[model samples]
Target chain A: MKSFLKLTYMELKLQLREPVALFFTLAFPVMVMVLFGFIFGNEAEELLGGYGQVDLSVPGYIGMVVGTIGMLSIPTTLANYRELGILRRLRATPLGSSPVLWSQVAAQVLMTAAGIILLFIAGLAIFDLRIPNGNLAIVPAILLSAFSFFAVGFVLAGVMPSARTAQAVGMAIFYPMLFLSGAAMPRYIMPDFVQQIAGLLPLTHVVILIEDLWLKGTWNLTSVAVVAVVLILGLVISRFTFRWE
Target chain B: MTQVIEVRNLHKAYDGVTAVDDVSFNVDEGEIFGIIGPNGAGKTTTIESVIGLRKPDGGSVSVLGLDPQTEARKLGNRIGTQLQEAALPERMKVWEALDLYASFYEKTVPWEPLVEQWGLAEKRNTQFGGLSGGQKQRLFISLALLNDPQIVFLDELTTGLDPQARRATWDLIRAIREQGKTVVLITHFMDEVEALADRVAVIDHGRVIALDTPDNLIASLNGETQVLFSVPNGFEAERLEKVSGVTAVHQHNQHITISGNGPLLANVAAALAQHNIAPADLRVQQANLEDVFLALTGRTIRN
Candidate 1:
């Protein structure tokens, strides 16, 4: 256990040492959120043209926050380690191999939380986006979304072992989740068939749960339950199929 | 001497091709044992299997009397290994790598002395990717000794090193042995086997073909010596073969070659004197490990 924590701390320190990656991990998502928020502010409703009267930019920004931290950052880092034999070297050490995986998960979780906080701060300060009326529900929504996306990232890292493949696969999942989950475009604007397929995606469910907490001040139990199920499924699949070397 | 490592009928196959086939050897305490083989001859696979990096299909391997397969985590603290082609992160500095690996063990030698002893103090802050191959090899060796382990495993330690670096590494390996640590060195360099190994097992096609000291293996070849000399004008190959202890003679232009077992040089000189032919340059060379390897395996070590 001591070795696990020590190795995890080392990993976290190493990740933070890369100035560019660190900046992008923390600052890029917030920059995108603020840029999109200012560009789409007040004009969001006008552009929506009576799509349930909900401010479209709020859900869009939330989805962006989830997608950047979850989809883009996680898979690339995991796959790079596997390809370079860093994971294999660590596994040969006395430190149990699970610590490396868990430490990465922990780093992503911490980074995701920071990114979400920045998004929230930017939304509240610049865009005048108010906190959800049902403040208690937002916690579970964010937590579930983080876990679900992390699991997706884990499975993606496992299946696509190469760094190039991880990037391609991350982008492949990222564009769809970004566009289809109402991050860039409103989900209400999509065709019914597209919405049905998008609804099956974990990102879609995460966005829906976040939208419920942030905009409506209510807990959507069914959506939260779906997110929970997807999180479990992703965890199991990654655990069984993950190849270290 | 007590056996520190023991393997019985170890076997490993990858995708239906056997990498290690029924190989067995033992390393006594404080002895530098080597497994010498050519490329793709299962040296790395056999060492990794003993270290528990790869599971053997059929075998019994015990390190310090602990089963590596079941007690890998526990045994890892006691064994130091420098694996072939294994690398750390590019941006990881030498000191960072050292500190990180040191943290994995319960008790670790201080990094300062290791850095000094390995001559890496100047590059401690440099990233791993920035170092040259010899520097990286030194750092790997430092990490392998960081835990102050009772046994160390080095795979192809001097594969790409220059002659100077190779000799320095050989000295360091001897230093490790002097410190009373048993070592398992895997290499294809016959000179390395001759210089450092106390006993060597020659592996070919995943099996041990011969095992003994370097001198014993050479002596076991029945004392064949190669004698070469530049014959003067008017010297014939037939006249050289008639010399005592000269079993056969082959000549190319002015150079004469003779193969024999006993009193070769003296008899050749006597015969040359009788023929009034004094060779300009006379030289006799004894057989080394390379000759023994070729004779036993029917293939040179490089091949």
Candidate 2:
């Protein structure tokens, strides 16, 4: 346990050094929240099921945070580690490779939580956003959403041949999911066909799950099942595809 | 002498294509054993197999009396490896890397002194990517020694360093041996083997072509020595050819090369003096491991 904490601490410190990761996880979501909150007032809107734009957008922004960390940060960093033989180097030591892998995951999870916290602070400070129904429930909601995305990220990193390819493929998947999954805009505002497509995306389920818990203090069982299935499926595929070197 | 590492008939193939075949060697304690070969000659594969980083398709490897495959974790604690293409995270600070790797082993020398001893005291806060090639290698050497392993394996440790850094690294390697640690030095540079190895296994085409002391390998070439000089306008090569221990002499225009055995340079010099022909550019060249490799493999080590 001590070794695991040390590894995770070191991993977090290393991840914090990356400017691109910081921009995406810490700054990008806050930027979007401020921009959207300014355009739409904080008053509860009938269109958003009586939730203010700040309240509704905060949970969707959390989905974006999960996506950015899982789809961009995790894949790019792990793939680069593999490409540079860092993973193999650690594997040669007496500690083997498991500590490195778990530490990386733990660091990403911490970063995801930080991004969510930054979003909440922005919502509260800028727009007088109301606190959610069940404050205690936010922990599991954020964790499960972050975990599901990390699994996808791991599968992408596992299969990508190089870091550059991983980044490119991650961006390719991320940008589209970001826009169509109600992460950038509300699903109710989109056309019917676009909403149907959004329903099929993993991020859409994440956004639904987070917003349901934040506003109603209840789980969206369907979104919960979809996100859970993605986590399991990603894990299975990564088992067959992950390459250390 | 105690044998710290033993490998017998180790065979490894990738996708049915052989990378190492029937390669065998033993490393004695407190000696620098070199595995010298050209690229793709199975040098890395052979060492990786012995270190348990690779699983051999055939043969057995024993390091510190433990099976490398079955007891890899135990063996890993006793042996340290600086792999050829392995690297740490670019953003990892020097001190952080030392501290992290130090945590891997059950016992370790304090990393602060280790880094200072490796001349990285000033670069403790420097990130891995900020280091020069030589500094990076020094950091790796320090990391490898963190556990104070009984045996250390270094693969291509000086591949990219400038001449001065290469020599400095050679001294560091000698220091490792001076600490009573058995060192496995792997390289394609014959000079590296000649300078440091107590015994070298010359690998080629995934096989151990020759294994002996560097001096013995060079001496196996009939101990041939060459004398070369630029002669005056019309000097007869026959004078030097008739000298005892002179096996062959070739003259091209103003240049003459004499190949022979013991004291050939002295005999040729005596004969040349008798003729009053004192060539100012005269020089003696002794056969080295490159020649031994060429003679064994029918090709130069590089091509």
Candidate 3:
């Protein structure tokens, strides 16, 4: 238990050391939120189903936070360690490899949560973001979003041949989802066919689910079911694809 | 001497291809036991099996009198391994790596002194990726020694280092032995075995072909020696074959080569002097481990 904490702490420090990853996971989301918040203030807009622009976009940015950590951070770290034989080295020790893995997961979760908190504070301070209507389901909805995306990241980390490949694949998947899933831009403005494709993405479900819980205090059943299915599939695929060396 | 490791008919295969065939050897306490073989000759597989990093399809291995397969966790605490391809994170600092690994064992030596002893004091804060090859090796040794283990396994420890770094690593390995810890050194380098190991197991094609002290293995060659010198053109070098301990003589223009056993050099020199012929470049080439390996495996260590 003590070693787990120590390892998690070290993992966080290492993640912090990577400037690019730090910026994308923590700073980028807040920057995008601020940019959109300034351009379109918290005025109720029919284009956003009557919710204010910042209020509606805040939930989507939170999805972006969860997606960045899941698609970028987790896969890159694991694939790099495996490529370098670091995971195999740790496995040979008395502690074995499980602690390293668990600690990594813990650190990523903490970083994602921290990113979300930073966005929340930014929205509240500058844009006077509307609070969720006391729906406790918002907490679980955010956690579920993190879990669904992280599972997909693990599958990518397991299957990718190297760190560079994992990063490339993650970027290929994440950028499209970020924009088309309405996490970066409103999907309502996109073409009908593009919106149809966005509906199939897991991040789309995370965005819709979190927004529903945050704005209307009601669960979107289809979003919940889709995210749950993605979580299950990612878990199953990672089991067979994961390689220590 | 107490035996700390024993293996019996160990066998392993990967994807239906044999990696380690019926192999066995014992490591005695307080001695550096060397396992030498060419690339892809199953040296790493043998050690990994003995250390419980691999499971053999047949036979058994015991380290520290504990079954390596079942008691691997317990054995891991008592043994230190610096594997051939294993590495730490590139961005992991030397001190952080030490401190983190030190937490894995139930008992550990202070890492500060360990880094100092291994000449990694100055590199304590340096990231692993930034260190030179020699420094990375030193940090690995320090990590292996952190648990204060009774046995240490170093596989191909100095394969890529320069001559100076190799010799320095040899000294560090010797220091580990001086602490009364049994060391297992694996390499294909002949001089490494000659310089450090008390006994060597020559592995080839997934089997133990020979096991003995370095000198004994070399001597097992029946004392084969080569005497090379240049004779005058058209000289009858064959006449020197009758010299005591001289087995055969070959002449190639001005060059004469003699192969025999004990004191063949002196006999050939005396024979030449009696003919009033002297060669300044005369030298005796004694059989070493490389010769022994060639004689045993019918191939050189490196392809």
For all candidates, state DockQ relative to the true structure. Answer: 0.57, 0.76, 0.70
The candidate, 1 or 3, that scores higher on lDDT is: 3
Chain B alone, TM-score of each model? 0.87, 0.91, 0.87
- lDDT by residue for model 1 over A183-219, one digit each (tens)? 6667877999999988887777778888777767777
Highest-scoring model, lDDT: 3
List of clashing residue pairs for candidate 2: none
Proportion of native contacts kept per candidate = 0.61, 0.74, 0.69
Per-candidate Cα lDDT values, in order, are: 0.82, 0.90, 0.91
Lowest lDDT sum, 10 consecutive residues, model 2 chain B, at B232-241
* Per-residue lDDT of model 3, residues B1-303, tens digit only: 899999999999999999999899999999999999999999999999999989899998999999988888899999998988889887889999999988888899999999889998999999999999999999989989989999999999999999999999999999999999999999999999999999999999999999999999998888679999887776898788789988888888888889998888888888999999977678888989999999997899997
lDDT of candidate 2 vs native?
A: 0.90
Which window of 10 residues has the lowest lDDT sum in candidate 2 chain A?
A130-139
For residue B170, give model 3's deviation from the true position in Å: 0.8
- The runs of at least 3 residues in candidate 1 whose Cα sits more than 4 Å from the true structure, single-residue gaps closed, are A17-24, A42-62, A121-129, A133-137, B229-258, B262-284
Number of backbone clashes in candidate 1: 0
How should the candidates be ordered by DockQ, best one leading? Answer: 2, 3, 1
> Considering every candidate listed, which one attains the maximal DockQ?
2
